[model samples]
Target: MRTIAVTRYVTPLREGGSLPAIAEGDDGFLYVLKFRGAGQGTKALIAELIGGMIAKLLGLKVPELVYATIDEAFGRTEPDEEIQDLLKASVGLNIGVHYLSGSITYDPNVIQPDPQTASRIVWMDAFLTNVDRTCRNTNMLMWYKELWVIDHGACLYFHHSWDDWEAQSLKPFAAIKDHVLLPFAKELNAADQWAREKIDKSVLDAIVELIPDDWLSAESKLSFDEQRTVYKTFLWNRFTHSSIFLNQAIDARKALI
Candidate 1:
């Protein structure tokens, strides 16, 4: 992930509970900044990092992620108390997704992706246990006539309760029925095979390494190595048990059909 200094807080993107903001980086690029101090906290950022990297590896379109440095003083000029408070709390490192200019939110009713792409997305959500990509809020964008994924902060939900991560990781993702693309995903089996081949141990390692140490420390009491190991174990277990999710997805697709 690239690191950039947030030069300006442009505006608040009030779509979800976290209240991510659009900011201008020192590099003159716009980024949708996910604050470290949001209600969901650092774990949300961790999910975003891992999920976004995996999506990229699967040949899905996702915005570039950056380490956005926020100074406490950046919010001094902002008149809104909520924005001011958010910036003050997020004084250090935060996650930023490169903003897509002139892009429109994906509307399934108007635009439909090919079965191959749709299957890939469905398989990805099932694999990651992402519960956010529903019909009401697809978390997808239409840019340059292509589908791009965004806002993966809600994935890898097993991490939210570390008490039984191993067991939780093995559970089937039945929520896939609500996935916006389920109706169009006719090639899930093929997508499953392709994803399994790409997301090996090395790929998981690379993605985990992208997570900043501060974020990990802020969220868990575990040591850095311990946290990394936990994440690796959870992902490996989920990948090994992917059949549970795939079967659920197949069933969901049939219901939609």
Candidate 2:
């Protein structure tokens, strides 16, 4: 992933608890900065990185992700106390998504995608165990006639508690019922075949490598190597047993219709 320095903080996108900001990067591109110091902390950034990459691998459209650096003194002139504190805490490294200018939030009622596309989106979310992407807050955007996914910080909920990650990997995702695209995801079986053909364990290994040790070492009780191993193991277990969640999604869609 490319690294860029944030040149200026444009504005706060006060949507959820995490105060993501629209900022200018040194490369003259605008990015939506997901601060390391946000309430969810760097774990969210890890999810964003890994989940976004997996979506891309499955032929889904996700904005480009980069490592965004912030100079320690950059936030010194900020006037807002809350934002100032956030900036101060996030001085080191953060995750940034290429901002899609003029894009609008996806309105499910207004735009309907084909059955295959919708099924693929639903399958991806279920496989990741993402809790967001509900109808009320579809973390999707419409950019230039294409659907773009964003804000995957809420995926991989098993990481929040490593108590039984192996077993959690095989668990069915009940939340698929609430997915914004579920109603249109009529081809989930085909989506499962897509996963079988397009993704593999090696792809996950590369995505896990993208996570910075600094983020893993910040608050995790596990060693850096242990953390990496856990992520790889958990994801692989889930990938091998995608049928569990795929069935869960089918049942949920049946209930929906």
Candidate 3:
């Protein structure tokens, strides 16, 4: 439960576009952190922490994460800095998906993700409400010839507030009809089994246990735990009931074959 302190706020990196960025520290690590949007709410904050952890648990090579606290002295002084310093005290973490190296942005065509690989990301996003990707620009990370997706602070269905998330609402994502879908629809369709296998109760319990008490109010902790229990149950018992989801994943991979 060691909350990383904001050592020195460095210049913002612009590649993240809408997301805020800066340098920060923990007991012994230096990271370029990404903050959730201003007044966004705890759901998004927890998503970055919990979602990153879950992705790691699922054996995805997501970036390392440690909960961070932002203080007033490090607050922003300009429009560009506003998002980074949104809360007088806020939580954030660094993403290892990409860096501010001399070169940025890669051609998706050159580093094509197979339907299975692409579907896995889409499946992760659907469960998380990570709307950063779409038909137009995937905006995923490409480093050392690998695809790494970052910037999930806006996930976990933040748009739904703290209410119990509906899985059917997540079904639309299973359909195949567009540029992004065309590439990975079958794989997305076939992912119901994977989702069922991956989103297990034991894993969900581990995630809740990892949340530091300081990051949550007593009431919030109660609600979050309740909701997580519900979510885990639904994913395990009912997620694969949708034929479209399983079919989209099948179609996604079929395109590649």
- lDDT per residue, candidate 3, 1-257, as tens digits? 34577676556655434444555564555555655433444545555666676666555556567566666555665454455455343544322222433333545656567766766666666555455565465545665666665566655553345454444434544433333534644456555457667776677667656654443445654565665565455444334344544455455546645
Candidate 3 residue-wise lDDT at 135 = 48
Candidate 2 residues lying further than 4 Å off, grouped into runs, are none
* Candidate maximizing lDDT: 2
Q: Write the per-residue lDDT of candidate 2 for residues 135-215, one digit (tens) a residue.
A: 789999999999999999999988878889888988999999999999999999999999889888888898998889888
lDDT score, candidate 1, position 87? 88
Off by over 4 Å in 3: 1-3, 13-18, 27-29, 76-103, 135-137, 162-171, 174-199, 212-224, 227-244, 248-257
Error of 1 at 14 (Å): 0.6
Candidate 1 differs from the real structure by a C-alpha RMSD in angstroms, to one decimal, of: 1.2
* TM-scores, all models, native as reference: 0.97, 0.98, 0.69
Candidate 1 regions with alpha-carbon error over 4 angstroms: 217-221
Cα RMSDs, all models: 1.2, 0.9, 4.7
Candidate 2 achieves a global lDDT of: 0.92
How would you order the candidates by TM-score, starting with the best? 2, 1, 3
Clashing residue pairs, candidate 2? Answer: none
